[model samples]
Target: MSTRPNDTPQTLIDQVRDATASGRPLRIAGGDTKAFYGEPVAGDTLSTRSWSGIVNHEPSELVVTVRAGTPLEALEAALADKGQCLPFEPPRFGAASTIGGVIAAGLSGPARATAGGVRDYVLGAQFINGRGEWLSFGGQVMKNVAGYDISRALAGSMGTLGVITDVSLKVLPVAPAEATLVFRLGQHDALEQLHRWGGQPLPINASCWVKDATAPDAPELLFLRLRGAVAAVEAASERLMQETGGVRMDNAQAGPDWAACRDQTLPFFTPSSAELCLWRLSLPQTAPVIDLPYAQLIEWQGAQRWLWAPASAAMAIRSAAAAANGHATLFRAGADGAPGVTRFDRERSVITTITQRLRAELDPAGIFNPGRMG
Candidate 1:
């Protein structure tokens, strides 16, 4: 139960440098919203809330840079005004989930494919490395040099090697419109349909599950974001409607309704009654797929899926994904059941050693997010 304090980059670097130089550990906190995202960390926590605000915003350039501690909501509002947005949808559980948290967790919503993940848009970032040195990487532009893409690498690094202070990103102009098609079908059919559509060129931003108690297969919402002129959006929607067989156009012109789909907010959060444990699985695209025991839906089929499984079957779930060349992550874990594990796909020994060395070098005293990532 580490409390939080608002601290600036200089202060954080000083603290981290001192801690690393010595042997103290400092907890990293941003919006305290994504605490459940990974394994717990020990020691006192440092909050970025105080280091807030959009450091830079160029609407014309389509790049709005901001501090890591800036509120996701604030970014959204600002981008909304400019008709631009962070392509990868990061869940804003509350004001606590800051841009830093999104980067730390590498959490992106269903709009990930066409929209891209958090790492994809990261142009440049300023952070305090473990040596406690304030460092910067990337630029305000989309393309950058090769080598260690520091900015993007930090995207899913989970704040282990360093603490993010500010980030610059290539924002996407907000789409003129979006349409959601809610199709009620068998669990198996829903997945097949989404994959079928994925192969074809359709204006789809996100394809995922909508688990409602009333309708088991209740409604599978496929989001198709349309940009450019109004006619283009309408034309794409019509083309999509024609291609989609059993899918029903729940909303031809969805406004804010699409935002509601950004999270597994409630029902999915409660794991006890909900037998389907949340597992973020990435399976083989063409494997002989078995309809997961619990309700299942596909997002970039062959790429990823947000699934629910029984806690008792954790080993089985991991095995299935492993055999199929994918991995699974436990999103919601119950008190009694072992929540799903969070290690990303396995890394080679060389990669692992390199990572461990970096972690040690950055946090020699080994304090910030000690076990959270390694």
Candidate 2:
């Protein structure tokens, strides 16, 4: 874990420049909280956590620009002071998770299905590319519809293209009120209800449907979060309960329940054994539940599903997901790793070609977090 001292943009630039000249690759490390994500990397460490802080925050304009190394909690606290928040509800794997890592990892939590992902809120970005040249894209203003959205493209890129230095994110005011409703139903029935509700105007913001893995015959529970105007939330709560025989969850129970799911603290995330791996499936909400030899936890109204299965079941799971017009990932693998397996879903050839071309144009030297997203 040896790393170069990079406390400023210039120092980081110098390190990257030296790496380029020496024909060496540099692994971008900000907060180092998400090291387990994606493919394991290899390169000299380029630490950016030292260069941190909020650069600009205009609460009136609902935009906050911060150094990439700024902690996610710090940014969220700042936004909370203004009664604003990141709508996508990005998760923090560690207490020191940085804004740069969040964007690079491109992961969003429960609200992602309703409010969009990291990219939607990314208004602009500044980064250092493979050639050690600083580049800027997009802007903080909402009306900035001028060019190709390179800033958004960097979201979920896993730092393969460049090293992010700063980012401009659009924020929204905190909801006036919120509530959680729970329903007990089979997986098929729960998914059907979720899709049916999607067509109507509801205050639903986030959802999770999970079954008891220990007892296959046990009933599944669906937790739905509603957030918006107080009246709307209350109205939706009453209507949903009556329609689905759902029970409203008390705040004492609701808060920790949602937090557990968002942070993967729930039992579903815990692997059963050394040979078990956590798999995440992303599919269309309309896709039906597929039969798999593993415990399943459905989320995002069925668009995102989690399972704990043996490492050898990767292909079977992926195939089932593909049949349902979705894809799967080996989110958390067992002790005996699945060697040579690409963690991410294989993309279409055209999409792969375009991605490769973009990588070549932005990181021809393959110096910035090589193979991180593959």
Candidate 3:
């Protein structure tokens, strides 16, 4: 069956209703960048490109609402104009990333440790559920809420739960000043420093790895940023230098470059045709198993890692990661290859059951994101 990217909300709903009743499963695709994120799928597809807009804006109230299909670039521009931004610093692959895509992926950057994840700032979302029935949850006002906080549940749910039409997000005023202090240390020292700062009453906005080609031993060059008043940043700078033995905060002339520290589309992303695959792993802060033929780059203060391994390395890597209390995802390479390794660290038995139940209620026909998530 063929479907046009319907423009109006009701039109989209009607389109989905008929499609679902016929036992048809709809695959919602946005921006098409994260297509490799979940299990591959071949089915009816609905594009949110037609349903785009910035429904509301209240600069004073620190919130903005937008259509699911609206590009994140547009949202950032709109917020910049208001001296405000998405405090969590969601990742954008390029110019075409959309708000809907951000929520679906449920990704957050370095600031996530300081502020919160993509779900925290979400005030509400409107979507057409798996059954093709229109469902609206949460709302625009900062504290306004739905019967259930289903709006946020939709964050990492991928599109398996619903087709997000529009969303209301809590925004933040841009920090008056920003700065970073780089610490060149090996794992033990780096983690120690990370912990030291973690215990301090300072402004450590972000931390990440900037792999240094010259030294594999010091593969991790940690970068930390500070936000807010110049004076506070200065004081934090002093405390940082004193604690880390003098690697002080410079102007961070390369602050923006550090922004790419998360969702880093490094050389890893290119040669887009490479049979190589990129996987995102979420694990416990301290996971002991560290066997890897692949290079490991981490963010979120080591809670999240991006592991690039051979397609065959999937299961071995996933097994190792699972033992360490984390999960791995086949997020890059095309799925045509027999996933030699586990595509995604299979969830725990408990989580597996819950996810199956939720999938049944959301995408009962298994129409949404077919194989990518589980």
Model number with the top lDDT: 2
Give the alpha carbon lDDT tens digit for every residue of 1-374 in model 2.
Answer: 11222334998899989998998988899988888788888999998897788888888899988888888999899899889999988888779899999999999999888989999999999999989998889999867857678899999899998999988999999999999999998889999999999999998999999987876687789999999999999999999999889999997899888878877888877776878888999999999978996889988888999999887887899999999998998887678777767788899999899889988999888888888778
RMSD of 3: 4.2
* lDDT (Cα) of model 2: 0.88
Q: Is candidate 2 or candidate 3 better by lDDT?
A: 2
TM-score winner among the candidates? Answer: 2
Quote the lDDT for 351 in model 3. 82
> lDDT tens digits, residues 5-94, model 3?
344588678767877788776778778767756666767888887777787788999888888778888888988988999998988877
- lDDT preference between candidates 1 and 3, better one: 3
Q: List the global CA lDDT of all models.
A: 0.69, 0.88, 0.73
- Model 1 residue 144 lDDT score: 74
**Model 1 TM-score, all chains together:** 0.86
- For candidate 3, which ten residues in a row score worst on lDDT? 1-10
**Structural similarity to truth (TM-score) of each candidate:** 0.86, 0.96, 0.88
Off by over 4 Å in 2: 1-8, 215-218
